[model samples]
Target: MLSTGGSALIAKKLGEGKEREAREDFSFLTLVSFLFGIAILLIGNIFIEPIVRALGSTDALLPYCVDYLSVSLLLAPAAMLQMMFQTFFVTAGKPLIGLMLTISGGVANMILDYLFMGPFNMGISGAALATGIGELIPAVIGLFYFLFTRHSLYLTKPVVRFQVLKESCFNGSSEMVTNLSTAVVTYLFNITMLKFLGEPGVAAITIVLYGQFLFNALYMGFSMGVAPVISYNHGSQNLPLLKRIFKICIGFISISSILITIMALVSSPVIVEIFTPIGSATYDIAKTGFFLFSINYIFAGINIYSSSMFTAFSDGKVSALISFVRTFVLIVLNILLLPYLIGVNGVWLAVPAAEFMTLFLSVYLFYKKRDVYHYL
Candidate 1:
């Protein structure tokens, strides 16, 4: 929500030549995000045990969950800041700096993971600590940059504008919905997997989900990276540029979708093997399901991009509707009905079915809003 709302508002302000207003929005967003993060930190820690148990963690898994989340929740503020700054960096025309910092954080995470798990033998807590610190690195650096340095965007005296807050929240609600729905969908998948095939079924789904995350990151990253430019063009009334960008985005998404689907299909066996030995029950299940699951990628890119594009245009209602339906409504319906209707294969088919249906909605909205946004 912070990233989407902040980026759109900031870019629009910049496009309007309202530099002071842009900085004020950025500073306001930064303050609000920090406060939200602190709230999460407190609430998460206070309810950590119940939250973990509610997720269906077993007795064996409870300790590990507690250990990890206890430390991880402490860095909620940093995580929130890091997420907000990523998009803001692009808005400020410092995308490369943001990318480099993120890469550095990832490198730090891997190194720390090895050291903590292998050398220090800190177990799950160590892993959580490492991850939290990884989040903190970019967050701290980004915060300092905004606070101390002169740039297109920087910290300023934040004017408490209720209208701005309302607009930002309303405009970014789709992203918030997307995130919340992911958690819900993941929980449902776990419960359904457990019912059908026990632990092996759960393991199999986990493997496929890991692959989903990696593959879907490509679409998500692209959408985020281009959102500021879309907002800027829209704000500046650059209709021609908006039209060109829309065409380029659609073309890129179309081509990437096909290529990613092919890559995923060809690499399924290797991906499954990485998690489990060949011929194992989990391996067999995941390998077979991966093929079916990967079909979602063919339609997911367009849906993802369409929702993001609407958000960039500051049409929160349309964007939220798209995200809510695509991620939660259709997904929940399919996850519940499909598995019962067609057995385990139904489980694999649920996401693809949802994404395919969502493609129609996305296209309809794109066509409907073209004139409104002047991106036809």
Candidate 2:
């Protein structure tokens, strides 16, 4: 919420030729994000056990959770800064640098994971430490860049502005809601799967979710990548350019959605095999569910883009409404009702049903906002 919200505000200021205001907003948001990170670190560490338990962690999982979160929470500050810089990089016209930093951090994390877990025998703690260190890489570099470098969007002496903070939170609420709702929905799915098919079902659903994350990441990245452009154009009232950008986004998402769906369908067997041995019970369950789940991709891109686009345009209320409905309301309803209605297939089909229905809402919003945003 902080990152995208602040970035959108900065983009608008920049479009209006108010560089100093943009810098002020950036600095203020950076300070707020840092403080928020610190709070998370302190609170998470103090309440780690209860938090894990609340997430439905079992007795057997408690120790591993402790070991992991004990190390991981230390990186809360770094994680927060890394996320903020990702969007700020695009706003500053340094997106490629951010991407390079992220890639480097990821590669470093993988290497560290192998060394710590395999060679040092550190187990889950090693994995957590590796991830924290990996996150720190980009976070540290981003801090240095914004603090010391002469850039279009660099931090300055922050002037406390409650109004700015409020606007940022409001504008970015959809992102926050999306994340929160994802956790809740995952828990619901796990419980539902456990009820229907036991541990194997939980494992199967997890594998399918992993695949969903892999595929949906592309849409998320695309939406984020274009957000600054949308904000800038909207701020400048460049209707022609905004229309062009919107068309391009829609076109790109449409073609990519189909391609990604096909790719997921074709690779379902291989993906399931990677997670579980072929002909195993879990493998069969995952493969079947994955095939049905892949159908969501066709509609997911549009829904995601719709919410993100609204956020970029600073219509946080609409953005949050779209996200809440798509991710939470419909998902909970479908997950609860579908399984009772159609047995095991209902669990597998819940997400697709929710996403497909959300498409209508997305399309309606696009049509309704056409005149206001001039992006139709």
Candidate 3:
């Protein structure tokens, strides 16, 4: 949410030829995000046990969760900084740099994960430490670049207008709702699968979700990359340019959705094999679930793009409404009722069903706002 809001505001400022103000807004938002991180850190430290218990951690898993959360929360500020810079870099017309920084962080994470967990035998503590370190590297680099370097959109002394903060929070509410809904839905998925298929069922769902995460990350990257352009055009009232950009974006997302869906279906076995041995119970369950879940990718890309498009246009209410219905209302209802009607297959179908259902709402929103945004 912070990243989306910051990118939109900065892009809009740039479009308006307010470079200095854009830099000020960027600095302000970065500070706000870091403060948010500090708040979460305190909360996590104070309520780690309660939070883990609330997450339904078993007695056997409590110690591990506590250890992981402890170290992870300590670097909460760095995590927020990394997320903000990833988007801000794009808004600053340095998307390639943003991608490189993210990749650097990911590579660091993998290398450290092996060293800490395999050789050092630090278990969950090592995992947490590695993740924190991974988060810190890009964050520190981004901070140094923005603070010390002269760039198109580098940090400056923050000029806090409470109005900017308010606008940002409101504009980013949809993304926040989407993330929170994901957490809730994931918990429900685990509970529903546990009821039907036990620990292996939950493991199967995890494996399938890992694939979903990988594909979704691509969609996320694409959306993030284009959002600044949308915001810039919209702010400048370049209707013709905005229309062209929107068309290309929708076309790209549509093609990518089909490709991702096909890949998910055809490569289900390969994906499952990466996580577990073939012919194992978990592997079989995941393989079957992957086939069913792959259908969601087709519609999910469109839904994701729709929400992001609205955010880019500063229509947060519509974006939040779309996200709330798609991620929470529709998915939760399907998860609760469908499994009862059609068994485990229904569970696998829930996300696909929800995404398909939300696509209609997305289309309506786009058409309804076409006159206002001039994008249709």
Model 1, 1-376: lDDT tens per residue? Answer: 8779768887998999999998998899899999999999999999999999999777877899899999999999999999988889999989998998888888899899889988999999999989988899999999999899897899889988878888999999999999999899988998898899987988899999999989999999899999999999889999999999999999999999999999999999999999899999999999999999999999999999999999998899999999999999999999999989999899999999999999999999988987789888
Model 1 TM-score on a 0 to 1 scale: 0.97
- Mind sharing the TM-score for model 2? 0.97
| Candidate 1 displacement at residue 185 in angstroms | 0.3
Candidate 2: clashing pairs of residues? none
Clashes of 3: 0
Show model 1 residue runs off by greater than 4 Å. Answer: none
* TM-scores of all predicted structures: 0.97, 0.97, 0.97
Query: Model 3, stretches more than 4 Å misplaced?
Result: none
Stretches off by above 4 angstroms in model 2 are none
Mind giving the per-residue lDDT tens digits that candidate 2 earns over 1-376? 9998878888988998988889988999998998998999999999999998887677877899899998999899999999999889999989899899988888999999999999999999999999999899999999999999876789899888889899999999999999999899989988888789987888899999999999999999899989999999888999999999999999999999999999999999999998899989999999999999999999999999999999999999999999999999999999999999999999889999999999999999999999998997
